[model samples]
Target: MEDQTPTRKNNSYCKRKIVTVLTATLTDVAQQTRAAAQDLAGLSTDLKNQALESIAQALEAATPKILEANAKDCQRAQESGLATALYARLKLDATKLAGAIAGVRSVASLTDPVGSIQLHRELDTGLELKRVSCPLGVLGVIFEARPDAVMQISALAIKSGNGVLLKGGQEAIHSCQALVEAIQTGLAASTVAPEAVALLTSREETLELLNLDQYVNLIIPRGSNSFVRFVQENTRIPVLGHAEGICHLYIDQQANIAQSVDVAVDSKIQYPAACNALETLLVHKDIASDYLPKAVKALQNQGVELRGDAAVRDVIEMDSATDTDWATEYSDLVLSIKVVDGLEDAIAHINTYGSGHTDAIMTTDDQAAATFCSRVDAAGVFHNCSTRFADGFRYGFGAEVGISTQRMPPRGPVGLEGLVTYKYLLQGQGHIVATYAGEDAQSFTHRDL
Candidate 1:
């Protein structure tokens, strides 16, 4: 019994050890990532691409190891009764792995955002001013079940000249470790510092990381609404990702029947677990009787459980959609349907109930489509296209940090450009501001050269 106590204590110590180590490691890595950012900032585009290429290759070589870890996570999630949507998100088989690897290579092929000069102007004889792009150092990314996120985010961090601290959900711990191992191996062959990219394992470590505003420059959280809101409230660091993905698709009266059905089915069924997948669908009253039954039947055949508003309930046989249903982000094989008076009413319902994430309208009527696209206050407003098109890779941004529903400049897909900010550089031969201040001061030339 006495001997067994020490063994039990040792096991307990191992379990709790990483939490303390993670705190210290995060503090240490923050500085290291900043230093790595400086080193990465000056490196050539080709070198960065080379690093990404190495990471992709290393990942491809380590597929079996990664899959084995993922399997363990999946098994545990099943036993723990994880939700169906998250379970789907957590699973990473060969196809998703290949896509993640391919995404890395795609990032490698993107135009380098760092060191790009946005503006160059000669102020006056030899006095020059330039605004150039630079990395946001030490990003802390906290995401949910998708282990593929680890690969995409790390690759983006490397390509964008940013150091990232990744915190994935507890369910995907083993998979995250396996992915990080391959990533670090690739980083070893690159110019980035050894500690530039890191992952924190324990749940306690994440709370500590939120307080690291001094070290972590930006925090991007991708998870449930509560999870994202908690991160935002706890962290002084800037949060840049959207939590609610209550996207909407409206079919105008003039919509092509085949086109509308195809986009609707694909949006909800092709990959319903995606953040940009359709959630609420609004059809014009003029077209509801004609379109609703067909839409409901097709969706039902795909195993989608439909919930509809009162008007929709009259048109299709389905569950009654409550107030809660309208506000929900299913992220599953489920959708809420409604019938609207017209394009404007559809737009109003979307703006009121939607998350400002992604909204689309399917209409052959050019005027109605134009009105809906312009009036709807969402990050992405598409015409005659599926809401699922609102993605970084699909939008040709390579691997993104995430979709930002922020109303600011980085309002949509957060690609490499979103990872960088601008710095104003002034070049002068001892030119003082006094010369440009008062009477008899030199007139400034703001001409672009």
Candidate 2:
């Protein structure tokens, strides 16, 4: 936590001037990053872990520099009127930096996902086949003002033996640049390629980056709905991310008031700006008489603004919530309350308005909880926990590239396993297709190995 920056051994790839030159064009960076990932795929697990450890050490040692850089971003954001929650995400102090470094160390301790044999099989005489996990080539990760995202993505990429090009929001340029510099410097000291991890500075360059579908295997954009949609439509490349986070928490008739209040406060107040923060609160009409007042008071005590329907307004003093409120994602200390008929009504409302990111239900009845969890269509469905638990680090992913709502292989918190794809390898000794084609066809044995 000293004031000085941690210095790395002299290497041209991470040098300020050199990095700028090396990342001149989006196409060039993509090609170079793909090449780097190809080399990374050949490295041993120990070597990958070493690179992650180096990144952790470097980040811990350079805490002061990172914070100082983040200070500038925070000051500028305040002057320019940045969103309250986004400013919170952008500012990195001693604690958040420590957590980021610890996450990297944890990733170092995880089992390597790449090169692991997923399946092995014996096919006929003298023929064998194996399916092994491998890196997903180069990744283009575009995220918002969360500076910690830079470190997390870089560490995850290295640990999974994949290459990354990180593009952070302009609001946290200084912080992102400093974090990437530290990461590339750490890579220089290890056996990994320094160019394996790069940073994009401008919006123009980032838009250009979305076009490199050939070199960039996957694009993960972590930001607002419009931003993610823009990235998805602008290129031919595959995109992995969610458009919105209109999460919900339904309070069942069988729910306990104290437990519901605690969860409601934690979900909205612990970190209101997060993607998993509860946006809508659904209460069964049968329990509204008992739960509405208590829920309002608990949330208001934490400086939360309550907007509710007519039935909820009758029990509490708050702003009148409209039909549009159901579909809104207020990423702040704002809560929308709606009184539903019962479990069926709550489920219908959530499915109609929820963003398919995360949803939770509070209930003492086993049947109610089971029905709610099974019927709710979301990436994460919780029975009684706070919605804030829907996070990558909380899910023990070491560090996530992003929370994916896409219905694909990498759903939910995308960790090391999400960054890899499998390849089928077949070995045969002088085997000819003619031998198994027609009347003299040989019987093949598909035995597991």
Per-model C-alpha lDDT, please?
Answer: 0.84, 0.85
lDDT of 1 by residue, 1-449 (tens): 00100111111111211112343454565676677777887788999899998888989989999999999999999998888888998999999999999999999999999998999999988899999999888889888888998988988888888888888888888999888888877777776665678777666667777878888889998877777777777768999967788999999999998889989998899889888999999999998999998898899999999999899988777899988988999989999999999988998899899998999999988999889988999999999888888988989998788888879868888889999998999999999889888888999888998
What does candidate 2's lDDT look like per residue over 1-449, in tens digits? 00111122221223122234442456776787888899998999899989988888777777888899999999999998888888888889999899888888898888889889989999887899999999888889988888998888988898888999888888988998888878877888899988899887766666667778888989998877777877787879989977688999999999989999999999999999888999999999989989988889889999999999999988877899998889888889999999999999999999999888999999999999999999988899999989999888888888798888876767888999999999999999998888888888987899998
| Model 2 TM-score, all chains together | 0.95
- Cα lDDT for residue 3, candidate 1: 10
On the 0 to 100 scale, the lDDT of residue 68 in model 1 is: 99
Give lDDT: candidate 1, residue 27: 59
The per-residue C-alpha lDDT of model 1 at residue 391 equals 88
Per-prediction RMSD in angstroms? 5.2, 5.5
Show where candidate 1 strays beyond 4 Å: 1-24
- Which stretches in model 2 have alpha-carbon errors above 4 Å? 1-23
**Cα error, candidate 1, residue 107 (Å):** 0.7
